[model samples]
Target chain A: MCIAPVDEMRKNHMTMLLHQRDKTVQQGIRGQPASLTGCIDCHVTPDASGTVARSDDEGFFCTSCHRAASVKIDCFECHADRPAEMISQLDWKSLNPINHSSLLAINQQSFPYALQFRLETRSMALNQ
Target chain B: MNKIDQYRRKFLGAASAAFVGITIAPGILLQAGNAATAGQGVSDAQRWGLLIDTNRCEPGCDACVQACNKENGLRSIHGPKTDAQWIRKVSLKNRKNGHVLNMPVMCQHCAKAPCVDVCPTGASFKRADGIVLVDKHTCIGCRYCMMACPYKARSFVHEKLTDQLPHAPRGKGTVESCTLCVHKIDRGDNTTACVQACPHGAMMFGDLNDPDSAISKQIKSLGSQQLRKKLDLDTGVRYQGIPV
Candidate 1:
């Protein structure tokens, strides 16, 4: 079995949770899926009537998992809390790794000096 | 003026509703007690904290990991992998910017912890002062806490904790993660293994609760972000963007 990448270990763990949380949403629990795999799957918009799915709603198949696991979830945090099909119109590729390296480099140099002080203090303690 | 009148009407409606039913939401009530639940005295004067600047983080050093293992009495496994890592170099590539964010992964020590909630036996909990931890003796090895964690910071003991120092105590079957060096912290030591092992000044730890604390002040002025805001974990750990 391919264990998750060390960097994405959290994602890997969430995937297992989603599977384990199967069929438990309506029983008065709140274990929603993590936003790692796909945002649209969890962050669905309301129906055409402008009503969003509730944990007790029949169509909120996704919320069911979260409810069963008793994990309180906020869907709008990752997916656009608008409508279901509209999510497809959003750019999911921005979440991919295409331009991540360059962004990391640009943001890398600006770390603050206070962080430096903590590191130095620890170094002295451990050495002794 | 019609637009202004419309806004005023909406505000009045909300204000009236609030007055009629002034019951504070349970979530809000829980928030007040959260600070005290961690079991540490989090005074405004001294809030413990940690910082890992990805720009400065380097791989292959593993000095912090070595020291943590030694201090915690962890045995070296087949790979340099062990469950008691207070720090590990994590490589991240920002898909949007293509920036390689090499960070040292550890517990964020979140203010609102999901891991603590999911633990059926209450083995996992945050101290009053805000250190998230596990009582190994009480842990049943369910790994439910691990699954609930958004940062993937918790680790499982696959084998027995061996070759440990007489003073260092850890073993198998329970979940473990970075304790912010609780033993060191309890002894009034500010140094953590990762902070000392780092040849570069990559990882920083301090009191975020303290207004004058370095990490707190840096977070306010620098605008760092938690790893996953969507989770609403309210993590004390913050990171500056990594350099190209």
Candidate 2:
């Protein structure tokens, strides 16, 4: 029927209106800063030497906004509650099997080879 | 006579001041002198221990295993059984003595934990209270922890994690093991699955900090021994499988 053409035109107009509305909404949504990455974005502190910034295991930096955003934080479920500075001071990495075994002599004496390894790394940096 | 009296009064005042100083100084000295005293008075003492009694333990109880799974958010998979158990009730027989012992085998939570040292990501570390645990977020799934564990306490998850706790979700490719129910311990509940599940009261859980605690008293009375003492892991869990 002749009414079918008018209906089609009307449908086309509605689609165009919807498309325009969608375009406007999309445009409004654009150009805004993205959502918070959390944890990954923060907790990274420059080393005492200030040459590099690294993340502590607990993600305290990321937690700054987590509390603000009302996100339940549970880093301590696996990580320690103490600050990374204290953990680093304990020479914890030296206790690892690969590192600690190297510290022991054939006679099983606790030698200082692990300390030497770190000194060697620092020397390598100094040499550079 | 007045000058002499004035000098005598001044001398008496000085003597009184000296007497007061002598008395007060020693009291203050005694109070401050014991600052470096040893034993319980020392604030920084760390006494780590573990207790495993075969008598009270169930032979094949998986309560500790399953409890650890839920507490740590370990998901069991169908394919290869990755990300399953952090603690398992292992039945062991001494070849020499021909004696069987039921032990809940998990992270020994060693004082000198091997997994902690081998981690390049610093994911594994011992807490101040001496509980060894893995920080899953930092765990790179390098399998170094699995290799480092002499007791075979750790396992790796191959499958991606779903249905995880919002607080502590299981991450893929990370190593996990029994945390000694640390989350519960932190929440003021001392019971881990193995300890709570052992209907016979085989496993004893308590803060080693308290000398009066049952675990501390049990170790003292029973003279518990650590597994692989030759390794010098300084394990917190002690085994009293044999008669003292």
Error of 2 at B109 (Å): 0.7
DockQ for every model, please: 0.01, 0.02
Native-referenced TM-scores of chain A, all candidate models: 0.26, 0.23
lDDT of every model, 2 decimals: 0.55, 0.53
Off by over 4 Å in 2: A1-128, B1-50, B79-81, B95-97, B242-244
Residue runs of model 1 more than 4 Å from their true location after superposition: A1-128, B1-46, B78-86, B95-98, B242-244
* Model 1, span B150-223: residue lDDT tens: 66677777764322332233466778788777656544566677777778887778877777777777778876
Q: Each candidate's fnat, in order?
A: 0.00, 0.00
CA RMSD of all predictions:
20.3, 22.8
i-RMSD of all predictions: 20.3, 21.8
When just chain B is superposed on the true chain B, each candidate scores a TM-score of 0.74, 0.74
Question: In candidate 2 chain B, what residue range of length 10 has the lowest lDDT sum?
Answer: B33-42
| Ten-residue region with minimum lDDT total, candidate 1 chain B | B34-43
* Model 2: per-residue Cα lDDT at residue B40: 10
